[model samples]
Target: MFDDRASVATAAGMRLAQAGVRWDVVKVRRFLGLQAIEHIEQPGAVAVDPHSPEPMLYFFVPAGTLADWDVPDTRALNSTECTTHVVLPPGHREAPPGPYWLLPPSCGLTPTDTLHRALERALHRPDPHPHFRIDTAAMRADAAQLIGDAAELPESTVLPQLVQRLRGHLMVLVPHVEDRMRAFARTAETRLVAQVTVGEAQRRLNSVPGLTFISEIKHAQTLARSVEALCRHAEVPTHTVAKAPAPTVGVVQQ
Candidate 1:
């Protein structure tokens, strides 16, 4: 955007800037329809987008230096015919240098690192909800009977479908969990009536069967995170720092 037209000097200046490794932005030119700078000389570095058909130009300058780039074509662009959109992506200035090496010792753990550790630990931890053990073969056979074609599908394809079916059945399954909990309470009450120890009742209550597996819980949470991250990555204009998805469940982590 040096205040000069495209010529040997302009090209040389661009080359010099590229070689110098300094940076700025993305410029968009809204012409008859939609057009963007699809590719550029530098891979992830600066780029320029200009309308080939029209007198207008679109440039990918480092975020802050839009004013500088538009200088040459300012008069022409500020006229009635031309329109330029200088889209500044999420701005980022390099962090000021500090004793970063000393961080590992001094900064105990960043919030993100701490969260990751907790989620990882939860994921690895024994499934707190482990209770019923399904007969895999029987379950597969039942599934195969219900969906004739799907049953013929390989395990890789079928297992996920089965799991999805099970998840869909959670509303049905939750009632069973509730019934079991009620039964446990009744038994505990009866035992307590018969003068059993409080510690014994507590142990029995804690031993109640869990509704699902630990691995499943952790995996669901992981999957949720991945989906959220994918959405964020897609939603955000640029790939700069975007907020992370909060942990929601377990295997996905329980």
Candidate 2:
């Protein structure tokens, strides 16, 4: 394992060794690998299999680092550890359809002791973003306003409770709308490709199971038509409802 900050010419950009000389490959789960990489300073060459069943990370450490490597949920490989060689990308960039370099080969090997400590920390450290929750405060406020307006109307045909339910549905659907709006903004910027812009939109839209972007938009349109009819029947001005700004999505802190 590398100790001093000395740069070595032999290790720079070197590919996997020939049959005789080799390096120990430390295998870690993707998330743990990310955590370990972030924690380690000057982490040496790292490779990733993005298409694997359970995506993996292969850290290139000095040969024999596995002899005393005792980190949990991580495996080390070498000629003596049931494997002779590991396949690696020929170059360092985002090469798809196969394992690629997440961090290309550099000056020195990853320190075994540092990696061990990083893996332990990765296992115990609290995740900053464990999950996501919708911020429905704005929707709730809009529902309250609609309810209050309905109460002031003479023989209001609209049920105040319907607004609450609509708000709940809209709150669920707003994220989809936000995603579309963002996609439009990205695609319209003239700098970004529309194809790439749609990726984020697709990810957000598919996040909720059984919900699709087109279906959500259809439901939102139905809700809009229903609300318009209610407002007309209740003698409420359409202008008043239109004046409310669109509700925004907020990230809740852990």
Global lDDT scores for all candidate models:
0.27, 0.49
lDDT of residue 32 for candidate 1: 10
Candidate 1: tens digits of C-alpha lDDT, residues 55-161? 23223222233332322112212212233323211112111121011011111212222222333333343421234322333323433433435534334444333
- Model 1 ranges off by over 4 Å: 1-154, 183-254
- Give the Å error, residue 17, model 1: 46
Worst 10 residues of 2 by lDDT: 231-240
lDDT by residue (1-254, candidate 2, tens digit) is: 32212222233342444211446678898767776765787787777776678778887776666777678888877666454655565554323345665565543578778888888987876532322222334344443443444433212234323432452333233332333333232323221332333343333322322245444434333443433322222221222232223334662211
Instruction: Give the winner by TM-score.
Output: 2
Task: In angstroms, give how far residue 131 of model 2 lies from its true place.
Answer: 8.9
Candidate 1 Cα lDDT to native: 0.27
- Among these predictions, the greatest lDDT belongs to 2
